[model samples]
Target: MRKILATHPLHPRATAMLAGAGRLAVASALDPKTLTTEARDADIVIVRAPLPPELFQGAANLRAAIRHGAGLDMIPVEAATAAGVLVANVPAVNARSVAEHVMFAALALLRRFRVMDRDLRAKGWLAGREHANSTSELAGKTIGIVGLGAVGQAVGHIAAHGFDLNVVATTRSLRPAPERVGFLSIDALVEQSDVIVLCCPLTAETRGLISRERIARMKPGALLINVSRGPVVDDEALIEALREGRIGGAALDVFSVQPLPPNHPYFGFDNVIVTPHMAGITEESMMRMGVGAAGEALLVLAGKLPVNLRNPEVIEHYRRRFPAGD
Candidate 1:
């Protein structure tokens, strides 16, 4: 049986599928040190956790990698492609879950729900009704989406139809998103939006895309929501913006660092809502990703190309190394 190594433990349902696959192995935990040992001779590495390029060096038999979800930021995609290893990710499976979380955060921040909840719990009533001026409705507000990927499109759809909010988006795609949604220049969208939502992926060009200078251009009291990777926004700049009230509030599901240190300034801010990178983490989403990843792994192991093969050029290199006749 071909050996399949899972870098981290998956959902219990995926565990069940592994048993059925009959050739699966899982590390006891998600630490990279453990993976280096567990995956040394494995034919495939299924990764959900961040790992450095060094880990790939130890895998002599690794023919392919399957990312449990979208986003290849954690997997060193370029290195894997150079090494002739097929890398695959399941995109769009988590779009609805992530879009829902974005809406949840946007509503919470827009309405000042967390602050009011804290006050009510402490004083038995709203300590100050006067703060209503700061709390606002979601309707009629313009929401600017930074990237028009699956998650961005999903968010735009909901924002437009469900809330009747004006939707504007910026992306590399020249293709517009239906007639009602307007495509704006990034600068124009950031300045005009009442709420700016980031649903983009992190890439070399996109790192620190939302810089301090851009933050300064936002409408005063504009809400910021990021469901994308952390490095897309400069964290120190974000703290400064929040501290000075350049922006009214932010809801972030991803951060520059995971398990944000207790002393992180974002934790102390009254206007920020921070979650532990769970924008795409839902029970339903997890199951779909698990099944999709497993399917990709199976196809790669059979010497056939998997759907969503991120670096398709890897196939040409693989064929050269292994030779089609062999």
Candidate 2:
């Protein structure tokens, strides 16, 4: 039987499926060193945590690294490709979940949900009711989406149709804009949007895309919602902006650091909403991601290439490593 390793436990359905394909093991810890050691003998790895590039060196038996979700940031694809290990991901499976999260965060920030909830329990109903005067409505507001991917498109649909809000987007694609959605330059979007939602993937060009300069251009009291990877925004610059009350508020789901330290300054601000990188994790999405990852593992073990292969260049090398009908 082939050996399989998962960085984290999967849904019971997925776990059972993988178990039928190979001798599956879940990592006890997620640190690079621990993952590298545990994956040394793994024939396939279901990746949830970040895998170090060095892991491809020691894991000679590794046939593929399958991401549990759409993001490729956690898996070192270049190293895996160089080492003849296939890289695959379950793309856009959680787009609805993440898009819903963007809307949730926007509404929460606009309505001061966090502060109102806290004070209502502590003070009284009147205390919470008084904040309603400051709260804003979602309708008629312009939502600027960064990156017009599946998640971004979903957010735009909801913003335009569901909430009767105007939608604008910035994307690298040359395709025509969706009906009722206006495409704009990033600078124009920042200046014009009442709320800015980041759904872009982290890339060379996207790293630090939201800088202090761009934050400064935002209209006063503009809401920022980030469901993308953390490094896409300059953390210090955002903090500085938030400190000066330059922007209205922000809802951050991903941070540069995992398990943000207890005293992280983000926790100090009532205007800032911080989540533990769970914007894409709902019960339904988790099952879909888990099952998709398990299916990819099974495909590779059966001598078939994954449907969503991220590193297609590795196919020739991978085929040589595990010859057909071996």
Candidate 3:
């Protein structure tokens, strides 16, 4: 019987799927050393954290590592391949969930939802003038997206059709964008946009890509949204901009530090909205991710290419190690 170990927390359905296939080892979380040991006895390992090559070195039977979501930054793909483990990630499965979260954040910030929630609880009246003075209509605003990938494209669709907002993007490559969407230089996008949304991946080239000067160039009163990795935006520089009112507001779903410190200044800022990294979580997203991971695991075990293999080259090395004839 093939053994499968699930280290990260996933939907109950994922556990059921694995159980239906073979022996399933489930854990809410796994220590790095314990996980390494477990992999040796397992045919597949699924997780959401970094899987160093050393962890798989002893896993003679390990065929695949399934990711619960996109963003392979946490895992070492090249290392996994050398160890003959196929690595796969589920992309676009959670795109709609994250895009909706962005819309909620944008609308919440523009309408001052946080402040109103606090005030109403304390005093109990919607002081008309104060609210009206702070709120802004989103219809005519220009929104610049830093990445034109799945989530970015989804956001563009909503903004153009639902809100009639002008959309622009600055992608790694200059590809033809949809109608009413234009490509701009990163600096130009920052300076011209009324709202700046980050949806890119975190790579060496993109680390601190949104530098202090880029933040400084943004249109005054512009709103900033980052659903992407936190380090992409210089956290310290962003704080400074917020302190000086150089930018209007920020809606952050991810932070450089997870579970932001209790005394973090971001919590005290009236113009900033913060949420735990939950932009990609939803009931529907959970189901898709669960099914996707299960399907990939089964494919890898059968010596077939997983549908979403991030490193296709790994197949050559994998076949050499586990010749489970296709």
The numbered model that scores best in TM-score is 2
Clash pairs of candidate 3? none
lDDT-based ranking, best first? 2, 3, 1
Every model: Cα RMSD to truth: 2.0, 1.0, 1.8
**Whole-model alpha-carbon lDDT for candidate 2:** 0.92
- CA shift of 234, model 2, Å: 1.3
Write candidate 3's Cα lDDT for 82-159 as tens digits: 887888988988988998888888888888888887787776776533575778888989999999889999988888
> Which candidate leads the pack in lDDT?
2
Model 1, C-alpha of 168: deviation from truth (Å): 0.3
Off by over 4 Å in 2: none
- Of the pair 1 and 2, which is ahead by TM-score? 2
Q: Report how far residue 284 has shifted in candidate 2, in Å.
A: 0.5
**How far in Å is the alpha carbon of 299 misplaced in model 3?**
0.8
TM-score of every candidate: 0.94, 0.98, 0.94
Tell how far residue 266 is off in model 2, in angstroms.
1.0
**What TM value does model 3 have?**
0.94
In model 1, pairs of residues that clash are: none
Residue pairs with backbone overlap in model 2: none
Per-candidate local distance difference test: 0.84, 0.92, 0.85
Write model 1 residue lDDT over 1-326, tens digit each, in one string.
Answer: 66888866677777676665547887766676877777778888888888667667777677788899998887888778777778899899999999998888888888888878887777766574545677888999999999998899999999999999999999987885764689998889989999999998888777898988888899999988999889999888888999998888899888888878889899899899999988999999999999888888777766678899889978888777556533
